[model samples]
Target: MQIGYFLSCEEYAPESLIQQARWAEEAGFESLWISDHFHPWTDEQGQSPFVWSMIGAISQVTSLPVTTAVTCPTVRIHPAIVAQAAATSAVLTEGRFILGIGSGEALNEHVTGARWPATGTRLDMLRESVEVMRALWQGDFVDHHGEHYTVENARLYTLPDTPPPVYVSAFGDKAATLAGEIGDGLVTIPPDADLIRTFRDSGGAGKPVHAGYKVCWGPDAAACVSTVRSMWPNDALPGELAQQLSSPKHFEQAGQLVTEQMIDESVACGDDVDRHLDAFRPYVEAGVDVVHVDQMGGKRQGSELEGFFAFYRDEMLPRMRELAG
Candidate 1:
């Protein structure tokens, strides 16, 4: 098992993200998972840089392999375009890039004034989009007109020698099955063992499985919880609400329902190495091959980011590695 760092594009600026990638490597992180977002969940979070640009920047600073924790290509951009961007990223990173994708949330994809499709339709779009991307990656002009998307003789001129692996992110059983059917790998953040099993049963056997979670570390546990509570109440928003909520305002409205206690109970907060270890045990038990973690509110040095890197480098990461054993 390997431990990677997650770069949350929703909360930090591009330069800070690049710095964190370097810091993550210095802190002993083996790989990187970067969130791809067009908007922050709350206005208070206040930042959303274009992910492709950030990936290019990160590639220059760190040798760590990078994956988009999840990018949704179905609505906001054409798959042909996403394929080209990903191809360039792979080349920039020297083939150290993995395209992690999913049926995305409306909060990010609805900005183009498009009606958000239902979950089933969105998943269908995701499948077709992946198909289109893979075909384009084959270095040929591709023409595709499908149920949910269209491509007009598009081709990826810049390509990697070996196509970058596409990892599908899924939460539901049907989605998990689809991940197994099409994905080169699987991405699950919550450590739902049943979903991993579903993926394996549905032709995903032996594919790499990746998992991740978020934590806040600081001098005071209460302060940490409060910090996470303010920026990430969306963590507790139940059901398909995460995927269905169309805007930051809708999310902020729904976020009102999340209680501070909910954040404390679910997240690994504060400096307690044990609490952080407890948060990671589930993923290790679920047989995950790689587990990436994000530290919230870390945009600067000697701030939340510094404290988090210190704790993980000195305590959490080493212990987690042993536990994974």
Candidate 2:
């Protein structure tokens, strides 16, 4: 399995993100994953930079392949615009980018004042969006009308030698199956072996499977847990609440339901190297081809962030490779 760093856009400014990309590449990460968000999950997280501009900066600084952990092409941004941006990103990165997409969350998309559809309808929109993007990536003018979107005489003038791979994010069987049918790869968070099987069974055989996990590496486990509980209580929110919550305030209110114990149980807190490995093993065992690790401890300064990368490079990445092998 390839190990990568997950850039939490919600917690870092654009320049910090570029610096982290450099640190991650120097520290031996093979690739990168970045969250795309219009707003931070809570006021405590404090920052959310535009992801495309960040991607442009990352392309200039790091040679490592980069992907949006998942961008929502179905709403807020039209598929044509996403297609153009993604195509430009691919060209800028000299083809080191992957367009990782999903059905989208209300937190970002709701800002456009569009009605949030049911899950099934959202999935349909996502399918159509992907289809539209793929059509535009062919480097020809595209004009079409679809169930959920329209493109009128639009074309991407600048194109990469090869279009970037499209990875679809899925959280359930139906979405997983849809990913199999259309995606060049699969992206998900948890290490659900059944989800992997579902994707593979439904025509995703041999496609790359990517997963992400969050950890807090520090001297004190309790302190780390406390930090995560305060900054990322949203991680512990259950079911579709994460995708359905419409605003940062709503998320902050919902996050109040999350507990320290829950955060401790879910996140790999503190500097226990073994604990970190244990957190990642489930994804490797579930057949994930790429594993992205996001360091969670609120907003970290350069020195602290460097320390985390150094620790992972020296103590964790080698063991992770061995375990995967």
Candidate 3:
């Protein structure tokens, strides 16, 4: 699997994100994954810039391909609007942009006061929204009056030469089946071979699969874990807590239960090159086409963007390409 840097929109400001894009290209990362969240998971993260603007700025600074780690086109934003933003992004990046979409969490979607529908209903909305976006992308006036959304006399004129591919994010079998049926690719987290197998068996065979991982790197291993625990404890929350929590403060409360050991074991905490490599092995073994690493180390004082890139450039990139081969 190829390695790419994941820009955490929730953690860094727009300027830092842009600079990281440039450094990631120089560091030999093949692609970029930028989170598309409306709010930080916790106040500790402290940043959430509009992802479309960041993509435009990043395009001006680097030639690396960009994809939203995942966007929710279902509720917080309409699918037609998302289609337009995505088209403009593709143009800005010279057609090197992809639209990764998901069923979304209430944290972002509830801002519009929209009902946080049941999971099945949300998935259905996602599927219909995708239909709306794709139909609009064809450069024809789309009139869609589906069960959840209505579109009357809508057309997207500024589309990429080819429509941007949609990569659906799935965390369970039901979602995976829907993704295989509609998505051009699959976007999921961690490295579960069973999940990948389900996608393939559900008609996603040979499609690209992108998995996300979080890791920490710092001078002191213990400190690294502490930083991760402070900034990303939400990632280790059990079951559907990550999805059901409606507010950042709620997440922070739930995160209090997460232990340092959980963060250390799940994330490759510390600067050990071998440990970092092993963190990605499960994804590779699962046949993921791209492994997007979001370095949670930046919160630690010593772990700046340059240091992070240097670690990948001098230590990880070459070995990773060999593994990908």
lDDT string for model 2 (122-230, tens) is 9999999988998998988899899999999988898899988999999999999999999999999999999999999988999999899889888788988888888
Q: What is the number of backbone collisions in each predicted candidate, taken in the order shown?
A: 0, 0, 0
Candidate 3 stretches with Cα past 4 Å from truth are 299-303
Candidate 1 residue pairs in clash (backbone atoms < 3 Å):
none
Error of 3 at 118 (Å): 0.6
Q: What is the TM-score of each candidate against the true structure?
A: 0.98, 0.98, 0.98
Per-residue lDDT for 59-127 in model 1, tens only?
999999999989998999888889999999999999999999999998889999988998889988999
Ten contiguous residues minimizing lDDT sum, candidate 1: 296-305
Off by over 4 Å in 2: 298-302
For model 3, residues 123-225, the per-residue Cα lDDT tens digits are 9999999999999989999999889898999998898999999999999999999989999999999687888888888889999998888877766889889
Quote model 3's TM-score: 0.98
How accurate locally is residue 115 in candidate 2, as Cα lDDT from 0 to 100?
Answer: 94
Error of 2 at 233 (Å): 0.5
Model 3's number of clashes is 0
**Whole-model Cα lDDT per candidate?**
0.90, 0.90, 0.88
How big is the positional error of residue 248 in model 2, measured in Å on the Cα after superposition? 1.3
